[model samples]
Target: MTMAYKNVIHGLQKDEGTKENLFALVFEQGMSTNAASIKLAIPRSTAYSWVKKEKEQRSAAIEASEIARQTAQAAAAENLKVNLFALVFEQGMSTNAAAFGLGIPPSTAYSWINKEKERRDFTGEASSKTAREISKEDLKENLFAMVFDQGLSTNASAIQLGMPPSTAYNWIKKEKERRDITGEASSKTAQEISKDDLKKNLFALVFEQGMSTNASAIQLGMPPSTAYNWINQERERQSVTAEVTKETVQETVKETLKDNAEETVHETAREISKETSVETSVETSVESEEASTKDADSVYRVTFKL
Candidate 1:
């Protein structure tokens, strides 16, 4: 009957879903061919063919939309809000309020709180260091502790101690082999490789393989500096990793403590009778304590050779 009907007859001679959708939004809705063309952003001829098909299959589109809506609603109820502060500050609710609303746990809320604190304190790496002569054994022990125990990389430790990248790389490479052969747990060894093999492998991965030092450290399961050193040495562009300051670390810790305090405040507030507002303020007054320059535990970065 129309030019549009001719186009639809030719175009959807194949696909059914497009035919059904066109039918539902046009013929069943009693929409004019011009209106359907604008609504579906298609030529009027295609709308006529869809309208003809929709007249034949009216029930299916209604059923599909109903199913989709129900599935979406169910997913929304079950989804956990992993970012607590966003659930709180952005949503204008407290941690307890957000957790209850989102169907998530209190511990998840606390983890997000600490994560937020770490994010806040992550200023670009800048620290002050005092160099001290550490014995080779002690250095080996520290390196082992950093890599294996602490899961840090060499550049991270070098940044903390303010040492040359080459110095950290050389020491770890020497110690890893000695520990492996002696069957001691002090240094981490490469699987089935000599000292020369270790250096060559490290160089190839850093330079030719083109992996970043941190990524190489994770792949090699060693420290960051070891990987960084090999790459730097091969390229002849030795760049020192900037340090993160004690002050920055302390600030991060303080923010964490503050979040803990807020959680405690929230827990206490939740216990008070909700039927009637009972304003009870419990203040924890601790006297001023001396601030120390050092961290509670020493943090070292380990470098991994690829």
Candidate 2:
């Protein structure tokens, strides 16, 4: 019968949820069309159509009662944003607390603060960085204090300091390496072992005791890859020493065998020469005896003839 009814006839139809929500706001909560529209993030015309449908079945007193309340809420929110901006920028009050005190959402307050910063910077009234922005040095100092004094983890400290976990981890690593912090162990072991000692133990385990490099490393609380590297280096060194010693032993054995062979040949030649000399002396003595016998026979014959 009214203009609202006319609008409802041509209005786009919404889903059941939207219709139920509109019914609750308009009838149950007694909110006006404009207020319900703002709260529901819908168009005022659409809310008016929904309200028209409600009005055909309900009374006008509810809408009138909620109009003043909705107007007041709209005005208060606008003023609250202004106050929140001033509190955050001029009075140094945190946006979160200011928003909570004024009954504004924290996310909306943060958005307003960012808008204010942008406006101020555009007008050349604000510096490049906001007063709330923390410097790298201050952040690092706070992170260090949180980790050392409060006993927070690097990740937790970084989160509190508004930094990435990786950045915090890298900074801590650099500091530990630079300061030679012995308290921090790579593994879960309470005691820290020196590299030389680690290498020695690894060598004894793998080479002497025939343990696998990975198992030895795990036993010593070292990384398996690191153990593998150390083992390879030690094996190379041993191999070089073994080659040198083997060559030396071979040369010594060769010289000893050569000396023994030469001495044996000289002694064999002397024995052969002594046997030949004995044979020649016996032959000469036999020849001399035969010649003497011949001379005795000739003397006997000449004496008998005279």
The TM-score values for the models, in the order shown, are: 0.20, 0.38
Candidate 2, position 282, lDDT: 88
The superposed Cα distance between candidate 2 and the true structure at residue 292, in angstroms, equals 3.5
For model 1, the superposed segments whose C-alpha errors exceed 4 Å read 1-71, 74-151, 154-220, 223-226, 230-306
Tens-digit per-residue lDDT, 23-84, candidate 2: 79888998887888898888889778877877775666677668888999889878997788
Most accurate candidate by TM-score: 2
Candidate 2, superposed: residue stretches over 4 Å from native: 1-196, 294-306
Q: Identify the leading candidate in terms of lDDT.
A: 2
lDDT of 1 at 9: 78
- Candidates' C-alpha lDDT: 0.58, 0.75
lDDT of 1 by residue, 1-306 (tens): 799998897665644655555666655786677786787677777777766655556567878888999899667633543444555444334455556556677677657656655665475211222121223345556665665455456656544443445666777676677766787754443322343455666666766888667876677655666667666675554232223455677889999999999999988777765423433221111111212212322222222321
What's the count of clashing pairs in each model shown?
21, 0
